[model samples]
Target chain A: MTLDLDFHSTLYLIGLIAVFVFALTGALAAAKRELDILAFVFVGIVTGIGGGTIRDLLLRTDQIFWIADPNYLTVCIVASVMTYFFAHWVIKIDRILLWMDAAGIALFAVLGTSKALSYEVAPLIAILMGVISSTLGSAIRDLMIQVKLVIFEPEIYVTACLLGSLSYVVLSHFGINEVYNILLSSGAAFLLRVLAIELDLRFPS
Target chain B: MTLDLDFHSTLYLIGLIAVFVFALTGALAAAKRELDILAFVFVGIVTGIGGGTIRDLLLRTDQIFWIADPNYLTVCIVASVMTYFFAHWVIKIDRILLWMDAAGIALFAVLGTSKALSYEVAPLIAILMGVISSTLGSAIRDLMIQVKLVIFEPEIYVTACLLGSLSYVVLSHFGINEVYNILLSSGAAFLLRVLAIELDLRFPS
Candidate 1:
């Protein structure tokens, strides 16, 4: 049976999950750098909300999502603190974090595209926004830690987001049900990411 | 004799100068890393516009300044290309670049504060935005190049911007003329930055 969630609620659920997972990845990355607790929180918060903040700004939304609802910021801080204290144990479950990150990327890709579409932006720019929202936060976090840029990595991260966003746009154009559209798009992206991770996919430099 | 330009025109002139100087610094940083031409352009564009972009996004402006006016992007690209090709010569004129950067910081600080006040943001938050606009672009560029954070350095950069923004707000509150407000605030910041650079002033860490 298909899920019965409404459109806005579905978006909210996915967005919250995306924030948590992205924050976890940010904290993990900071842990690798041996940064202080404050640094962990800083990187985590930036990575968690950075993409959506950029999207909201571009859309000229009256209030940024996190600023309007402080709960998102709280989630980021709590996740970061948790990660900082248990980094050693968390590192042991690194594979799980990778998969969670993949899921987060898929969700954000669709959400960003949908938000842009609602704003009546052109479809092409909407897709770009989706890719940007899914990937920019992590990229910024990587920069903060002085690591090699993730966008330049051989992995199929941004490509997965692009395809997912494209799929969502096309499905919506055809008047598909929102549930089916999200599921198909997110599934496609998630599968691509998982395959890339397992198969060691690399783009030519 | 006092200058006769309107507030808006003067702001535009200072903004253009700020973008050019910031782009130059970004290119110089990229050159030290032996980055390719694309990387040079990328860093330069990001450094030149990143702060204002952040400010505009936070204020929920209808269109980002550079996107609405392609001239800003063109300036960034041309400045980046010039710096990349003449990096050796550019490095030799490092003293001039430093002073120019100081001027940029001062101008951006005032501009950022004024924009936020126009949006009716609280004075305290407006002051914070001013500091962010003045310093964040270069900070991001430094991060991309993996250098120690400039804010962490004892150079008093943020402090100078903070004082400048505060001065502007206070002057404006007292019904000072826009020209005088801009000049006094910018002069204060520029002088402070020049002193810090020349005296090797370091804040106690």
Candidate 2:
């Protein structure tokens, strides 16, 4: 089987776009903090790249995403610069940040799981990586703001990623097309998260 | 040879102490930022448990440190509480914080290397894990404060841990006593870090 070079490359490109969107949401989240531009951009960069960086390190990838692909860095910087110039505009879009975050998480969770499986990790471990890759960026953002861990919070954040990874694994085991598996998995995660938010679903205290 | 159950049992203890040291340093650092007691304790726990947790997840170990040994959680909480009440006093001894951090790094480095080796990872991979274990706590602390990544900085932090792990591998190849290997490796890391600070040595630009 010729390596699905086109499909794999598309995933990488999608990942970079997700990074930009993630950074935009992060920039808006920090708008009220009275931070200087550098600090704002720094937080944005961290929020955008932190999860994948963690995933790469854990997977023992030879080079991390931004290190391997400077395009990711370029996009993050551009997004951050845009945020700095248009903080007021970003602040107005805060209402949509959660959905944007959900989109980013869906992309990350599916891609992370696929990457882990490609590395021949156990399915369970791959699923865990998926959850981590999705939640970790937001987790880093919250930690920087010194908030409680979203992983332990009431939301269905990591849980959605976990279920999505499971779906991918199960579908792949049943011989589903790789691209379709990823799309289905990411869609599952995105819809789950959006529904959870809309319904105000939360873990019981 | 049968696995050394005694040494295995004591490994958790070493990890526990490292967590306590990490927590205390993190709490002290947070206090300097004017964070409240809850924030200080949360920072402490994150600093304490973050590294080992990352290492474990990377190694696919089901038992994370705080999960396997609740004593570590207890230790982290206690250390946080102690630092909270005594931060001002401890800050007076701020000269020692770096050294304490270095010591914790050294301990965790060896522990992490050994664990990686036990999992049959390549020596190079083990060395990387050793460095991650040693430096991950401080990296998380820096990220929380939105500081530039120390790994990207000129600091000799990760370098010292790598050198120590290399020493361990060399000693093991030469059939040195295991305990001596651990001690020598850790001691070397501590000395190298302390000397680097004193001599103002840094990673070459």
List candidate 2 segments past 4 Å from native: A1-10, B2-49, B53-205
**For all the predictions, what are the DockQ values?**
0.14, 0.08
lDDT per residue as tens, model 1, A1-205: 3346566677777678779889988999999988999999999999999888877777677788899998889889988999999999888888888888898899889888988888777676677668778888987888788788775465788788988999999999999997889889989999999889888886442
Q: Model 2 TM-score?
A: 0.58
Compose the digit string of candidate 2's lDDT tens values, residues A27-142. Answer: 76566576778877887888888888878876777789789878887887788888989988877776586787777888898888888888777676677568668777777877
Q: Clash totals for all models, in order?
A: 0, 0
For all candidates in order, state the fraction of native interface contacts they contain: 0.18, 0.06
Evaluate model 2: give its lDDT: 0.78
Q: Write the per-residue lDDT of candidate 1 for residues B147-169, one digit (tens) a residue.
A: 88776687889999999999999
> Which stretches in model 1 have alpha-carbon errors above 4 Å?
A1-53, A61-131, A141-146, A152-205, B1-7, B57-64, B67-70, B199-205
Give TM-scores of the second chain, every candidate. Answer: 0.94, 0.88
Error of 1 at A134 (Å): 5.4
- In terms of lDDT, the poorest run of 10 residues in model 1 chain A is A1-10
TM-score of each: 0.61, 0.58
In DockQ, how does model 2 score against the reference complex?
0.08
Best by TM-score: 1
Task: Tell me the lDDT of model 2 at A152.
Answer: 47
